[model samples]
Target chain A: MSESLVSRIKPVLGLDNKWWWDQAAEGVLAIQRCQGCQSLRHPPRPMCDQCQSQEWDFISASGKGTVCSFTVLHHPKFPGYDYPLIIVLVELAEGTRITSQLTGCEPDEVDFDMPVEMVMQRDADGFQLPYFRPSQ
Target chain B: MTINVSGEAAIAGVANTEFSKNSGVSELELASVAVRDAIADAGLKPSDVDGMTTFTLDNTDEIEIARAVGIGDLTFYSRVPHGGGAATGLVHQAVMAVATGMAEVVVCYRALNGRSGHRYSSGVAGPLLTSDAIHWGWYTPYGLMTPASWVAMYTQRYMHLAENVQDAMFEIAHVQRQYAAKNPAAFFYQRPFDRADYDASRPIVSPFKMLDCCMETDGGSAVVVTTAERAKDLKHPAVIVKGVAQAAAADMESMTSFYRPEIARIPSMDIAAKMAYEQSGLCADDIDAAVIYDAFTPIVLWQLESWGFCDLLEAPKFVLDGALRSDGRLPTNTHGGQLSEAYIHGVNGVVEATRLVRGQSVNQPAKEVNNVLVTSGVGVPTGGALLGRSD
Candidate 1:
């Protein structure tokens, strides 16, 4: 999508979260995996809740998940986005659930338990975000 | 340690600004007016008020309200965090303050121009620098930026498990509107809606038509809390604070705590339900009236189940069985709630609960109202209070 056509909702790049955005811009979906217990966490936090270990690093996600739930938002339209936006909560193969937009699919076509894979789409804000689409 | 603060404090007065889409006044002015009215209703002067409390998101500060209301306070001012979830928590804090002699007269208020200025429905946009905002950043990039979107994640999963839940949700909205129609103070006064209207309404997030979402209202509400002993000499009947509690489950997020064992069950409220009953020595069956927060319609049913009003999967039928009617087994949100009344966060529900205990509600239930269950926000770390008449 062209920059002019996209609506750029910028990410908040804090000291703890800037890395996650950097990884997404590189077309990779990465999440925090506690080195102490290997328990994966999303919405990356500073320390591992499972082990309370401050020492942790990111792991590349499998890019595959199933739709645990989904919703189509129609009101309060945002810029650079289509009406009737589809948002999905996916249970990733790596045992963590993530929230991402489902693109390249009709609202009626999306359902619970549907398989999807991650794809990178840059928003008008000049930053890339991970989006999911139906997988064969 | 049980730490029973039950009946130690009581709500002596309640007041509210007229519900409107635009109040044409500053939030501080709204706070001042409501606080003054509440204090006078309690038969107390401004000098009698020594403490104040409100939510952090509320734009008006305690000192600002004190100055505007001509209150000269020296001790006890606090702010509770979280959004609508902090409603009953405000009472909890006041009860603690009054019970412990930290302050004699504590007033809790929430005043906001939610619809006219800084509408929450417009969705949040900020520096995104706070810890909570940072958490929201993960999903906002994907177009999940609004509160409705956050709650829709759980609603969709709930429907998957309870196939016929939509019928119950539609009925809940319709019935609440019916109650709202009777409430002269309600935003939807004289305008009752039915199932067909719910279906015809525009979609907000899936599973939530326009009626499913509460109106963003510009209003303010205030309550007065003092020791039970002091309340005995006040103008109106004292509504004893039987139980006050704030609870958060493990790994609780503000709104999007979706990784629970059951995506549908509100764990924080479950914890709150247990705590409130334990503190008050009252059971779910003891409640004659309830004011469950209705920021969204689906949460009301979720609360009914979490609070043990019915089985987890039986909430749909429980509500469909006329459970919310004025003559039903448990009348709920008789003031129409945020959906039809007004959204001053959930503090308005607290005021309604007080009115129920005082037998002063516009839509008072037919049964002799003794105990009332009031809840804060749901779909997040939540709180609840059980209020009863101080016979």
Candidate 2:
């Protein structure tokens, strides 16, 4: 199949590309911080879940955390995605947990509590996808 | 306000479409078929139903369902969010409506073309970058993208906490598959899994094999609820809605409740279990059977522990000892859970609980079941309810 055909079949959201590219240019990993609790959250919401407060501020994180958990995907659900991609749940120092893919090492090398840091990788659409790597 | 425990509600009717990897039907059609079957099973007409409930993720609107089924008027209708946790919560809403005389007869339904339609296993995109996605974006940029990948984080931590915990997660998958093997209506019926099969299965996330995950199926299920009095007059015996409860804890978020003090604990489900136990006036020991929402295998372990069936860190031992088997102390998911039967957003679990109480389940327990406990989705703000055999 041609590239445009695949793009038509699996449309990529414009909002995601803009946000990811913005972070990559700045070389900073940011999360939406709920104004009410001053806590970081994922899947950015219009309102704070803790206090139902809608106000949010972009906050840069230390980008340092331990691997709370991980999975080695042997079956890629989508085409072009290779086998054995390390998907991880990272417990950030800011006291929140988030899910992402782990890169920079072999799948077997990834373990629980292994200190990891973030790295941006470009997708087929030139959108930067955040993947993790061992800090050491 | 005191709920009348003696005056219970029953599941007078049950119905569902065939479970399969592909169902050549729209979600609306699937839902209608299940609803029609349920009405017929109750020996009643669609016009008789006055109340309805379903999950938040379901695409079929209540008004659409009401119109499609040709029901004249609706007195009560509700939609519960939070994935699989809405399973028994649907019953909770229906029972309250019936018990309060808000609606005489209520039907709860869930329909999905999960496999042939939208597959949840697909990777995350920017639209998912909502507040939840923003949080995951921080991590996804690093690598966690799917539900199994997200849950794998907690499961690994749980295993790290307990050394004796063998592949107990496999025990849960194996049991559900075993029950499904005997259930002709199950998606995995006639195909049983063993420890070796589980081990050989590809890993989705660490500690979770492909076999550990629930299969995506295209199907629909509906249950009819009516007052004990009305149910007694219907075509089947009344399976009383003994108790119902929905709960969410502080710092609770979808799939990622790790910010709380104890990442391993499910405080929301704990609260729901306690409320159900107290309201029903029945202990865990009184539950003759249960239909725990098993969207993922590790959740079953957490639910069993949180419900006080066993202490923390002992869920593996509980399952390995055959405690959750059909003939075991607590027969669970007798119709095959989301793991083996189908994942209609946990509504099928309500159907199984009703069948157990009605003595119509394919994997009926050895003992006479008086109390059946059914739970909704896990890893999010969830719901649960207890169904009893009316006297």
Candidate 3:
């Protein structure tokens, strides 16, 4: 199937979210950093909630974080994902959190506060998404 | 300062349509049935209902139900959002309306084919752009799509903090199922499970076995609200709306609120609980029965902690101590809760609260049940209420 017509769900491409996706596709995990307050945010927003600044810039994070929380989904399988899929809330070193899939480990192997590093994982259609893995 | 409307409005009637996995009828019909029954339970004609309210998530609107039920000339109408969290807030709106004379008789109802139609457990299929959808867009593609997955994120963190997370979760399921065994209306009706069964159930999301999840039931529940004085002339003894509150913290998100500093704490619940106590002038110790929302078992413990019935880290010990039994410290969900009973959102919980207050609960407590605390959905903007007997 063509990348654009793979029948796999993809993030809604919009003015606020397109930049992050474009950056992630290039193998860099970028987050919105507010120009007014330097506050970093994930799942990009139109305005910096803290400083109310519509002005922002993207910063490529260090790709390192700790698992603040996680869940292993085992039922009602969806397309483009495996069963017992590990989803994690990673608190980035820069002090913001993002929800992403965690690969390279068993469901029981992931623990809270475990150090992880972000890596680019793509959907069947070739859209890259940020996923995390345990750091040695 | 929050205006305390305690004892101003009373729940004169509470009724529900048959509980089922599939009602085989439209949500509108279910709403009409539940509303008509609730009004009759209050010993009032449909014409007496001049106002109506319900949750925004409910497919059946007040006007539609009003039209079908023959309720005329609504002086007040409103809808509270936040999914099941608005269950008790429906009472809050109705009470506020009746207390201020905006409406004399108000009916609160929620109807949906949650199972047969839009199953919440079945994750959203989307690329939608509603504000809520925007939040889901962030993680749904990453396989964090369903409500179970979102709650599991924090529940896993909760497990790390608690001494016996798995055992505690299983015990909650076991206790509620035991209650369900006695209540014929429960989805699990006579199918009680042991701890072994809970442990062996299929895992939907980590830290959440199949037993921990509430059945997505298709049904409707409705309650009637009126001035406390008028309730004295009603069919059943009045269940006073002592206090009602809806609260959300600064960082509160719909369901995935992991971005906050403390993902384990349900701040919205704590806020609502605090307001319930303050407005009602009653503490956790005064509550005789509680109908804590149990869409997921872990949430029951989360709410017990948030409501200050026990310390945040003491819920497991609290549960193991038999605190949820009919003769225990806080006999909870005497009607089996959403975990075992029908998941009519949390409105069924509200109805159970009225039953306990009226001494009509199937699993009535050993002691006199006076004040019953009914909490709505957690993991989102939540609401809480304190219902009590007038004397």
Candidate 4:
């Protein structure tokens, strides 16, 4: 209600997950892989769950994913944001899932197992965020 | 060896301030009133309380509340994390404290002017502390702000997997609201069920209508816990703590834990239920009534399966079949739940559980309720409890 759907709000970054924002800033969707367990995790943590290993690395994702789930949020709208926001949980081709927004698509356009592709977009504040659109 | 807390401790008394959209009071005032009333309900003086437990999110302080209630010495105190999921965990904490002889009388309370004060419906708007923002940092920037959105992601995945679920979401709302319609304490009291209303309701999050969400109200709820031996000498019938457990499963995030193998399943609920049932020595069949968390409608479905009330992914039909009705197998949240009743988080559910076990519920079911299962919220580190009736 205050302004356009795009707000200048940015994610608060810390020492551990700053690298994730760095990847997005460069227009690359990246995921964290546990160097010890050979498995992947996200949001950039220090330890691994499978083997309790504190070792990890970042790998560039394929930018391909499926619509694992989604929602059309309307009420309690935020400043500089439109109503009925389309938020999606995408299961990346790398077997891990990530949370992002959907652009260039309608609400009814979303479906279960819908295929999507990740795209990095910059906000007015120059903060890069990962988003998904219908994969061509 | 660990002690079996079942029957070791009991809830001697329970009390709740009026559920309202605006309490016109401070959270500390709410806490003070609820705790003091609960102590009096137990036929005990405020001086008898030596221990206290509450949610870490609660604004009231232990020392402040102790001072407000005019208590003597403070031996045991704890603050459970995970928002609404800390409901039953409070009882678990108090039971442990009293059972271990660390404290004589422990009072657990959750006080919030959620409507007039900090409303959860707005979601996490601005940044708080760095340490507390772990979960939000991952999802907040991407239009995932509200608790409804966090849950919507899971509900989407779950509905996709279940496939058979359609009207169950609305029906879950219907049944719970049906229960609320009968209870004067509920916000939706006397509001009859109308499927058309549910269908016409505006969508807040996909697969979740406005009715699918829990009401946000300002109120306080509290319970007094003591050793079963001492509780028997007090006021009302003692509701013994049979089994209680808390859990945070593998790959646990706060709520937006979509990175797991499948976002559809709630491992937290499964783990908590397994542990609680093991502690209570009761299976799904043993539970006569339930107060499962209903922060959202799909959560009830997810929990029904995770808690072993039905087969995996079969809660849709199970719930649609009126399994939650009083005449059905399990009369759940007969006090209307958070959806219809005031959202005092989950403590109100436990109060309703105590009523059922005591055979004093207004919407009392036909069956003999020997045991009641009460759960806190899922999607975060959560907990559950099984309460039993005494002769």
Candidate 5:
């Protein structure tokens, strides 16, 4: 997992979101949860929509999920990523979704509701990020 | 208490600079010219315009547009965010201004050098400076940054369950182009393509072909809104703002509302449709024509279904059955659309809806168009409005 297959873009980390990337780097997939209302949120937010609680914590999710949806991009030919890139939305077993690239599969080989598991990879800048691979 | 300002304000004027690849001028100049023309089209002096609304994405400020158009002061001025989704929101802002006696004549305008300057499709490459960048950060690392890619997340899921969507997507583009063939202001005017051209077009993002994407043209479009009573004395027939709703659904991310329970549905548009129907007291059956935002072909199907013009997974079938043709049940995008007309960020759509209600569209439907539904961007916080004649 140290040697990179291809360099990737680094995320613009923020106070609340930085924690998720930090957790992914430590071999753990973390999801945010509101302490007061016990509600879970993705892409991490400061407050809870259910109870207006600014207080929250995280849950270590099982890295197993299913690809709910995906896209194969060809144009804009962005640097650091291969063409016909397949990015997927994986619905985690704990009932929340996470966005990441689907690795180890061709764009044509991917299908809806496919089973996938998370993998940690380091970009060119040594920034660790999460990716999804098809379940064996 | 709900603000039922429905039927109180009307759109009295609609104008647009020609759609082209290069305007050879600044966006500020385009806004001034379009605004000036819209004021004249409303048959009102510049001094009479006291309010203004434009997209936050627009380069020109209201004071700058006001100064350039020779207007003195403004009692109410605002900008709606969310890019193209702000089209009908501009109308909402204008109607509210006139409704509360804040401003007499409010102009909603959008001008951009999308082709000649910064093409929007290219902005997704990297490093979006907006505050929303925080939300996009999670996706960009995986190269899921562009609007097409973001929308594909939903479209891929949609096509998975639907039938004949590929054919329907092409037919929507072709049908809009058919309407564009008759519009001199359209980018594709005098140029109509057949099924062969569609098959030949390359797919940019798997489901979306090159021809399916909207035109990135350099142009400007503006509309004038005023009180229903004052609009009656204008040069042209007044198209009353019978219903307008701006909806920012929960858990919405700019274009990447992928975390929603139903990945294929546009909750914002559904919310806007419900609010609009409640405000106007008009059902989908009352709509005679429409200008559904065509940023991409799939968007038309989404809006049509969201606005209740058709059922879920039924939009493609609706298009395949010729529901959008001039002689079809509901004539749509008679001035073309963002696809064939121009991408003024859906503001041109509001202008065209005004034309349909005023009975002045170039390719007017054979059936009389009174309640014309106009919508802004989807997959984001969006808006929609129903326009019809006060008479």
Candidate 6:
């Protein structure tokens, strides 16, 4: 096994990197609103996958989604990693789905379709990995 | 009510690039080389091919492959999705094209420099950046960043239900590596593994060990599909495609299918096995040999149980008794399989199936192989087929 790296320097990117990144930076979630099917999308792409149309615009989101599924990791795959991390598949209010880590709670506390919102956290790598918290 | 028939779709030709960790060739180049070799193997020219089928995940598209391989035109060309599940499904699509007269000669191929170019073993970087990535982002902070980690959860549950039948899974790996050790083309050829090796291997997940996982490789393999009538006049004996089927169960995801009624049992495989048996008119007793997908060792055990080769909980016992060995009741993964051989998205399994029916396999079966069962991936939406000797 290789020696694990410690005290890693994390690089942070500005919201200008991508539209979705910008939305994350502003604390207001945004998804691509398809002109073809009028469906909303996340992690913004160039075109609508459903209709394959190039006409898409940014739409502000409710920052609310339901947990479609989840898995609790009892083992840390990497060094400086903590165990019992909860991961959930969040289906956004617009019906667009995304995967994020559930935070602010323990593993058994999470359930399917449980409402959640994105919460960013700095990992051991110094990068802000998106974590989710149960919605009030 | 469906009528079932048993026959064969002759394998007109076979070709594959040398297996290696680094091919130093573009995926398109690799695919073209294999296709050309397959065309020549059939004693036919490139223009003879009228159809093509491959995996949707493949970088090389069907039209691009046709153009690169110097084919004039194509009447049928398509791609199957669901990763490794499309392995045998590609051949099935080609057989259908030829059988239905949509095309005379069809080629099915998979070419990937998976090791040198793109490593799927790396953390799930691609999916994390897309909306799909965002969806997965919900999980990654929880530390589920790799496919192995996702599969590990289900494997643990399976082991628990089987009352800690870890030996059954290890036994399947033992048999596969054993065959691979004898076959010169296998990566582990001349390097046989035993139960101790499996036991000593490091754990990837709770139940899956390093040895249980398949290797990542770079190579391309191609199979030519033509009518049984045409195969009779070809260069090699016709290894007909007897039956083929693909299925996706409810609540299916890429690797995270925890929403299913039973995570231990792959309902998709059950659906696929039934369809394949019905189409081929052959049950487990009729199969002379098999080349089951072994992406993970536990999947092999589950597949055996689901296919009715043994009782659900009796898988470990069945494997311990050497039922899956080359000299056993039903020889499996005679080409070493993904575990010991190369993982060309399960396409190599199809190549071995063809060899078994032709009586020309490096790890040939003990008895005459009248019928052979070949399955594609097990997890997610999967596919399978039964290949046989054309009378």
Scored against the true structure, residue B104 in model 6 reaches a CA lDDT of: 83
For every prediction, compared with the true complex, DockQ reads 0.01, 0.01, 0.01, 0.01, 0.01, 0.01
lDDT score of residue B290 within candidate 1: 95
Error of 5 at B366 (Å): 1.2
- Mark the regions of model 6 whose C-alpha exceeds 4 Å error after superposition: A1-136, B1-8, B126-131
TM-score of 1: 0.73
**CA displacement after TM-score superposition, residue B175 of candidate 2 (Å):** 1.4
Q: Candidate 5 lDDT, tens digit per residue, B1-391? A: 2679899999998899877898876677678778878888999878888999999889877886675456867889999998889999999999999999999999999999999888888746565677767787888778887787788778899999888888988888999999999999899999999989988888788788888889899999999999999999999989999999999889987888777788787888999999888889999999999999988888888888888888999999998889999998889998989999999999999999999988889998878787999999888789999999885
Give lDDT tens digits, candidate 4, residues B1-391. Answer: 2767778999988888889999876677678778877888888888889999999899888777676566669899999998998999999999999989999899999999999888889888765665868768777778788999899999888888895565888877888898999998888899976889998988998877899999899999999999999989998889999889898998888887888998887898898888788877789988888998999988888888987989888999898888999898888889889999889989988888988888888899988899999999888899899999864
TM-score of chain A of each: 0.92, 0.77, 0.91, 0.91, 0.88, 0.71
Candidate 5, residue A39: Cα displacement in angstroms equals 65
**Poorest 10 consecutive residues by lDDT, candidate 4 chain A:** A45-54
All predictions: root-mean-square deviation over Cα? 21.6, 20.8, 21.7, 22.1, 21.5, 18.0
| lDDT measured at residue B156 in model 1 versus the true structure, 0 to 100 | 89
Candidate 3 residue lDDT tens string, B131-222: 76777778977888888888899999988888787788887888888898999878888998887777789989997889989888898999
Give candidate 1's total backbone clashes. Answer: 2
The sequence of per-residue lDDT tens digits that candidate 2 reaches over residues B45-140 is 888889999988898887766665567689999988877778888888888888888998899999988998888777575466345656666567
| First chain of candidate 1, TM-score | 0.92
* Per-model B-chain TM-score: 0.98, 0.95, 0.98, 0.97, 0.98, 0.94
Q: Could you tell me the interface RMSD of model 3?
A: 19.8
Candidate 3 residue pairs that clash = none
Give the TM-score comparing model 6 with the true structure, all chains together: 0.72
- For candidate 2, what is the TM-score? 0.72
